[model samples]
Target: MPHAYQPPQRRSRLTRRGRLLLLFTALLGLGLGATVLLPLLSPGEAPEKPRQLLIPEGWRAAQVYAAIDKE
Candidate 1:
């Protein structure tokens, strides 16, 4: 059987602006994905819990050291 002659289809090409838009979209997606997944990839727990020390209103570091020195 003989095949009928057919015209070739025009290939679609991306313009420079379209290519830049695609690149921008891809980078934006990657950045958002990293932001979402970063917390899950971090360490499970902090090494130590934060502590708050209480000191009397008028006390100073020097006074604290002097008190410790007398011990």
Candidate 2:
């Protein structure tokens, strides 16, 4: 009697768990890279402007000093 021939098996395929782990690792790496690079790529914040006080015209020196101190 003649025996049937069997083909050689391949071993490079990943299991379901392995594929999920690989996907999770890739996503984690991408998130980490973005977290590290986003700050460096973004423009700096604008500087704050100095506070200003508008005093009425003809104000006395003492009044002006008081207004400045009050603010």
Q: TM-scores, in order shown?
A: 0.51, 0.49
Q: Give the range where candidate 1 is weakest over 10 consecutive residues by summed lDDT.
A: 46-55
Task: List clash counts for every candidate, in order.
Answer: 0, 0
Candidate 1: residue pairs that collide: none
Q: Candidate 2, residues 9-57: lDDT per residue as tens digits?
A: 7878999999999999999999999999999899979878899999999
Pairs clashing within candidate 2: none
Q: State, as a TM-score between 0 and 1, how close model 2 is to the true structure.
A: 0.49
Which structure among the candidates has the greatest lDDT?
2
Using TM-score as the measure, the top candidate is 1
Q: Which sections of candidate 1 miss by over 4 Å? A: 1-4, 46-71
Which tens-of-lDDT digit does each residue in 1-71 have in candidate 1? 59988899898999999999999999999999999899889877766876555556788889877766665
